[model samples]
Target: MASSRSRRVEYDRFIPFRSAMDMDYARFALTMPSRPQRDGSRESPSSVAYQKLLDECILKNRSRILAFKSAPEAPASMLPQFDEPIRPQKKQQRRIPREPERVLDAHGMLDEDGLNLLDWGSNNVLAIGLDDTVCLWDDANKSSKVLLQAVEDSGPITSISWSPDSTVLAVALGNSVLALVDPATGQDVNVTEEDENQTPVLSLAWRSNSILTVGRSDGTVVDYDFRKDDTSICFYNGHRRGVCSLKWSALSGRYLASGGHDKLVHIWDACMPVSHHHPRRHQWLHRISSHTSIVKALDWCPTRSNLLASGGGRNDHCIKFWNTVNGACLKSIHAGSEVCALLWDKNKSELLTSHGSPKNQLTLWNYPSMTRAAELSGHSSRVHFLAGSPLGGVVASAAADETLRFWNIFETPKTTKPELPFAKFSVIR
Candidate 1:
């Protein structure tokens, strides 16, 4: 027994125990199975001591091992990689389809050159010039009446325009005169005629309550101020032929656009003082002669102030959009026929154009892109005039067929609103 004890102690000295944390020592000590001694009993003292030490070591290190495993600050190299990559979010695009809600017939409408035949008032009244008569049609009540008539000697009514307040209407006659009439009573409030030079008034546009610009057959536009003692302010001359179309920009009250049979478009600053001594009576911003035929279709963009769109006659068959600020031609589209009139959508970025020969149709277009949205064909003759209602999204077109057509092309879609037809669209806006 003494000799066996000595041998066991010598084996323990060869083990070289440094610390209990050594994984190899712990595995060897803890995993070893008990063996029977020479006396035929179970575990020996050295083996028993090792088993107790291993148990104590595991108990002491339990909390530390658990804490290290649960910590979140693990190195990047220890993180697992993913197979699939993340994608970016997609944006939704808005696309409005081309469709008409309804169309109406307007009889006794005229198709004349150098005439502002159709106009829509804020009170929802549409005034149309038919031959020598001026007619008023109530859009809300759907009624029509003869507003005024000119004698055969005085010639036919050439142009008509409603005031901003919808109270007064201006009627241009072929006899070089302009008659301001109250639509409520169908009576002339005042009549203003051109000077003795005998130039007839062809087109008329009202800029404000005090300002009226009249385009003449002598290639000049006369500014009439209601506030001044001498109502005839001055004349602005540019075109070499009859000025057929005149429009004042709503965005900038000072900007005016005039087109004529001379195949020229003149952008003028109307606010400039008329001085014959200054060499240039009118402040001409741009003189665009891109049209090969009569440039009668002229309109300023309501959404964009500096953008202008003009259409040409049968030979040109093109609608060109211009940037008034820089005098640049932004876009141009061929209508396949003569572009006679233009109307810009107020609530949306769209354009409505009327054609004369070949097609004689009304076309709805998307702005900037100049893409055709839809083509409305009904008129048997040339579609020459277009007017928009202040009630929103309703347009009335007059043609040479002596018919006026109403179209709800820009009407807003509403599924949840009540059936208040007249006020529904205006209320939503």
Candidate 2:
């Protein structure tokens, strides 16, 4: 009975089995009987023996029920709780605004929307205007007004050219007629017998006092001689496409270069003039098949007359310099965008090209070396035209963004470092 009491005390101590060892022992006792029977009968002894076994089984089962219920009610501090909610942090975004473009002027400022720019002969003057009105201003005279104005054409004038002497100004009208006006008198010459085919004159160049070359969209280069009064001069028709650019060399007056939509730069000897009554006798000097796109602009270097620069066309972003004598590409510069216009600096050693689309960028390059010199960025749209002053003081650029900007090239400060304070001192402190 003392042993039975000791066993009961041990069992009771482990009544609430919270650990795995206690629970395993409890399961083993429930599955196996505590005592074996001496009789041959499979059943256990009856009465007191059965009651003792029944009581032990009931106690063990009751303890298991109590432990399962109390296990869930234990303090949460003893174990980690997975049901806790978490909050996330919010992020902040910053916005940056774009900056507006600004223009700088060294001498004077002109109003916007002025197109068709021309630098007058030898004088520090410029002519610009729209429709029938033209304004000429002297850069030397601050108080001077428009030097000349004329209403010479009925339709809007599409093109303007100054004669070699800068005495006569020729205006090409939108209606496919040409008018010659005197800049000093603003009077139009009545030389108005229009060509029957009358295509819009795309470009104009003055070859001499007697001959004026006009390029049309019909791929015809016509010469109008002021010396003859009866019929028009000879028309040279070799370009199978519309003429986009024309240049007459100042060194060799007979050599004429024209670029067209056919992607070929045709060099013609204008000296072999054909009479209006006879067939054309002009000989093709050389053809440059360098540009793969339409040539929009061509400029002959004043210092190096044999070197010619041409640029423009869709997706063509290069400026090519060609030697007219041999028809070889001397050098090419990648402008990284479609080159719309090109101008040689007054010194003829540096070339400036204006690119369009993606960005309006102006790039200057050392001519024969093709090395990048500088890049000017300010325009917001496609730069369509660039004109450099003969005096090398200023450069004027026009863009589709409805603004004209004048860059003062002469105002660039020299890169000499300032003298040190000690170096400038005399013998005394």
Candidate 3:
């Protein structure tokens, strides 16, 4: 057996440098002393003998790519890579060949006169229009209540949308009145148009907490600020026909997309300057005349801020994806039936489309590839509308059959990190 001192010496070799820590050494010298300065010419004494600067300096005088003529040689790469490597992975199948988890007999849920009244709120509640009444169905409790019932002049509910915060619901009526309903009290703050030949409010979208964009049937889109007394921020008159669909970019809150029955999709920039010196009407960034028929469906990509999807009406059964950054057509698929609505999966790179007439089925497709992953069929008639929850796992479909169905379309992982929905945001100091 070796001596204990020898074993101690051998053990110290395997550890990190311990010259300053080894207490048994006869002389303990400080590697870096910070007492004071040296040379005592009005300066302090040797408080700290600072690290000595290298006397011999060497630098290459020539230029090189990415190196800037550093003296050190290239270091070996530690990246593990291989060619033609194939291995088994945990393949997760899309929730396929399944029926809706729950179904409710939703009477008077048909789409008429270009009105789609289906909106799922962030507070786990589903809202649908029953001809003249706006009903709220709580998804967590499966209980519903008649939130509002239109009477007399306000006959039918044209469109319904929940705000991002889910504190207020915007309900559009047939008689050109936009009612902002507080879900807690079922009270409405009505906004009316006083024009002699009044047009109906076809679509509505919330740009921010205070700003709401109301699209009228006469092709006039107004950005109304409820916080202000004047209310009207600006107006967009690009569409020649009824503006049917409106959606704002979720991340930047800059681009507002609108689709109209004139077969045109207009992308408006909220940052468009409205000068007080020389005021002008808000102009669209891009006027896309791609669809041959009425354009109604509009949705901005949840992951990609500049990407957008628009679907045409019956005469044109095509769903075209657009890159709003440069107004480029990314892809276009000819859906057999009239594409009613388009929704992106919140967790995966998948898209869900509900169709009308002929084959009234819901199809989930793997995006980018555009391959049909699964086809769902439960509705007897044309599936006119689709609304997904905030998380996008479960989707609610309303059809002409006057029925509402909920499908668990997405398979969520056990644990997931919350992704930043807005890709660009300043660091909060």
Candidate 4:
């Protein structure tokens, strides 16, 4: 009896919600006689004999289930005993309204890939491209100034981006020229010499205050160091068509994402060692070729360093999320129209996308869940651009209808100390 007690396997503890078939299987397993070779250990005769009567003998009788008894109690998991403190309930997300907070008239025949033409500077200024001119609107003062007017032959302003420090602005012209301007004094800082190849600069992204990445119509991407001579530091040549978008990772500033009319997005490593075989050329780390149309929208996650979001144009009309660490696609959703621009909310795990024809509206989505939170309609034409304000609460969207709208979709940032840009630096004694 003592030996039998030692092998008391709690196999008949019926888990709550278990089906009748499950109980029968459990009984079959529990009633099986132990074979001596099962664990390379011989069961004692007395224990084996006991098991035969309680398990095998009963099964052989063919009606032993009728004789079964209820288990003494449920397992510990079903108990109500406390094991840890209760966690506070998560704060619910604030719902975004379907109507925008404000709207303004903006006139321009904006280009198809005009993602950079509308940018909100860190200095609370909005830079907008209207026809052949570039205008700066200060949100604080509610005033406007024209920063640049391109000559008709020079081509319209294709793109404009502010440096990380917000001291200088980089403008790309359709004629394949770049100009750096100071925002405070509204003066030209540096203008690049016309490209000998004359490949129109289609997109611009600032890697740093003095380092800028330029995407051209010829599918070549150039990294220029403006600290001195505006020398080309690296060249990424993978796209076969015009490069429409270029965005650097806001987390580590190590990964650069480029998308284009080639229906491809390439992730490039900024710190790659130069190859002696091709000194100036650098190969891409991951080539994502899932989109079926022009991919003009690309943005790195502000919350997750390894996650990226890309959107396709009219033909594809899909938004895809990717694990940049391995180039694995995590999720994809059909937007039903051209996804012209994408942005992630800084205060929440949410995503916003601007669309083209059919709806010509802005969509706010709950991340990971991918559920629609709000669909805002205002643009009379394709909403080709989106820019978030410096304070992280408001967003400005530019559409082909020659108008810009502001929406209060994000929560106002909480009062918190700004993180040190260079964490390693400290005050010296």
Candidate 5:
């Protein structure tokens, strides 16, 4: 009797626990177990066990799906917190205008190579060498006249330079002779005897109104005193090949720069005293070898007394600026194409370069900064020669295409008014 009473207590406790478990299974979408036979008479125990297994499987699958939906780590990168805003970049400002002011039909004016065929005289006259003839164009009066012509046996006129006073012009002929001509009368006032070797006189520069320097093919430079009747006062020998370009700085007065086909640029000091008079030397302050090819393009900065700029030929394709006082290379620019000529604006800190081959175009660069300001295009061939006008802002270019184009690139802006066309310049026939 006591045993039966204990069993009844145990049954009561287990029944309540089983009922709580069934409620939990129902909430989880699981099937509840059916009633089982106490004495194994109504049904087999295996069937009761199978029913219990099915309820557990349903409960486990439901729990797994609930856990998956509440996961915190999945797809974290797709959240709104990962988004960012983008900003735009600013562009560089252009400094120069690209259009040209005038285009002239220089049908017969172009030379075959990189001879300085164009020069602007301080007296407002333009001198151009066309083959065997040297012509003068008066900008003030709009009149053109043939200044002089080469002799039948002489080669074409190679270079021209006007005196500082602008009263006379020094012309270099192909037969290795130099002539002084009067602009007003269009006649040679005096001519030098033929060179002993007959080496072509490719370049000439005036150190002053009375002193002139001529460069020859054998790389010898001779200084002549106009007051002494074409007699050479001194000789400078530093270049290995033809001396093709020469520039004398009026600002510095004593510095003279010469460039040669052997890829050398030398700066000479005319103020240096000679120790003896036997092919005696004028001091060569610097021997610049920065240019790898013929150094045809040379110019001195008008504002900076010691600064000099030079450019190389097709293979070199570089422009270098130098400090003539110390012979230090201050700046270098990789002009993609051949640099044929260089011009510096007197009124602004701007420099212009005329190029050949690939992009036969003109590039305007800001000084010191060396930034490209503008690119002027129109010429179909290499632009070899360049000259800047004394009229403040005008520059002219002569190209291999036999055309002369003028650009007022450095002109300052002004209020609009009824003014004559800037491009209107009379072509003297």
Candidate 6:
């Protein structure tokens, strides 16, 4: 064992320097002495001799002390160098454009240079065109050629509907008349011609072989039957505003669904037909007042006629599904932006919607399940329209960017065949 005094001495000798060498050495060398003694004298020194010795010490050591005090700090230069090696910046990732799954490039078929409306025929052909001209395309063969092109009076074609058998095409034009044409021969049937006073026929629906329903922007729904020979079987004046959408139910020929700018959906029955003279010929079935803005589009489930879906002009930017029989809302699907177009998948269990301003996004959802399956965000603008292929293998979307996008929804493997009399639902936002 060592003594305490010796241990203290060892600690002092071995201890590391507490400060930089410049600070410690400069402090020691620059300290001033209290007083100085005369040469070989044991008595108090004279003031003059003390002054002289003090001056000499300061002058001799001043340069050496300053050199030590001004020494450069190593840590200042080393910190930045150490940081550079430890944390390097990362490179940003870039997005690549994808190839379209299918393209519909054939021209001279749609109404004008651009397509205004499109509908699928019973035979899987696409019926589309601008005012007064209807063209049909065989979807299976890219080069199959235009199957039929029917030309009517010179006016903008607002809407088109194919007969259930795909044999007849009903067209509504700005001329305020409805024309039925044979798709196989491009022959005009000349069903009815009306005066220009009943202007802007916005929507048309074929109820049966004998009856057709026409909804006008002036808020009138007219039922014209060929069996009656040009007679207006029913005239609906209940819509307080412009009618935007119309549909005839396969389940009940008398039950017609109409949506309008009034943000109300009115169900009319054909069992009781009112004349233009009778102010109350139309009977209102159920009115849906859920939409806050003008209801842009609506569709009854083809398989489940009782299930109805509507979209557009909602504050939440969502699509609502309802039980048409009971007028009860079944489910609502939330989307990132206002849904511009809504379509039902071939399975009838899923819904496809397109959104985004300058509209470029496409999303798929499983119905009732209300879960999103996929999101397609490649387009830079709002998607204006969407159409699903009859075979359920593909979807086509149009945008204001002057481009069309084709999506392959059937890229995933399927396990079973879809059961029919399919009651799939469709909604357009």
Please report the candidate that would top TM-score against the real structure.
4
- Model 3 lowest lDDT segment of ten: 48-57
Task: Give lDDT per model, in order.
Answer: 0.81, 0.65, 0.81, 0.85, 0.82, 0.65
lDDT of 1 by residue, 140-245 (tens): 8888898988977787788889888988999988788788999989888888755477688778888897678888888888888866678877668778889999
In candidate 1, stretches whose alpha carbon ends up further than 4 angstroms from where it belongs are: 1-108, 193-196, 272-280, 413-429
lDDT of 3 at 395: 88
What ranges in model 4 sit over 4 Å off?
A: 1-93, 416-429
Worst 10 residues of 1 by lDDT: 32-41
lDDT of 6 by residue, 1-429 (tens): 766765432234566556524675556556845222335455455765675576677644243435655646475756555445566678763222244565554333231211235677667877665334555667777533343343455466677777777777878776676778787777677656668677667667788766677778778888777666646876776787777777777656657888777878777666654566785468677788877666655666667768777776545376888776677889876665666666776555777787765335787777778787777776666665666666665776655554555787533326787765534646434
1 versus 6: better TM-score goes to:
1
Give per-model TM-scores. Answer: 0.72, 0.63, 0.74, 0.75, 0.72, 0.63
Between candidates 1 and 4, the lDDT winner: 4
lDDT of 5 by residue, 1-429 (tens): 355544443446645666346665455444424333245556588876775676587544243434556556559777777456666777766345577777766666654444677889999888888878888777678677788878898888888989888889999887888899999887787888886676888788888888888888888888989687537898887888889899998697889999989999999988877667554557577999878898999999989899999999978999999989899999998999989999988867889999998779999998889998888998889898888888767788888787778787765534466867654666634
lDDT (10s digit) by residue, model 4, range 29-120: 67877422333247688776786687665565333455457453478788887778989999996867777887787877575663468889
Model 4 clash number: 0
* Clash totals in order: 1, 0, 4, 0, 0, 15
Query: lDDT: which is higher, 1 or 2?
Result: 1
Clashing pairs in 4: none
How well does candidate 1 score on lDDT at residue 254?
77
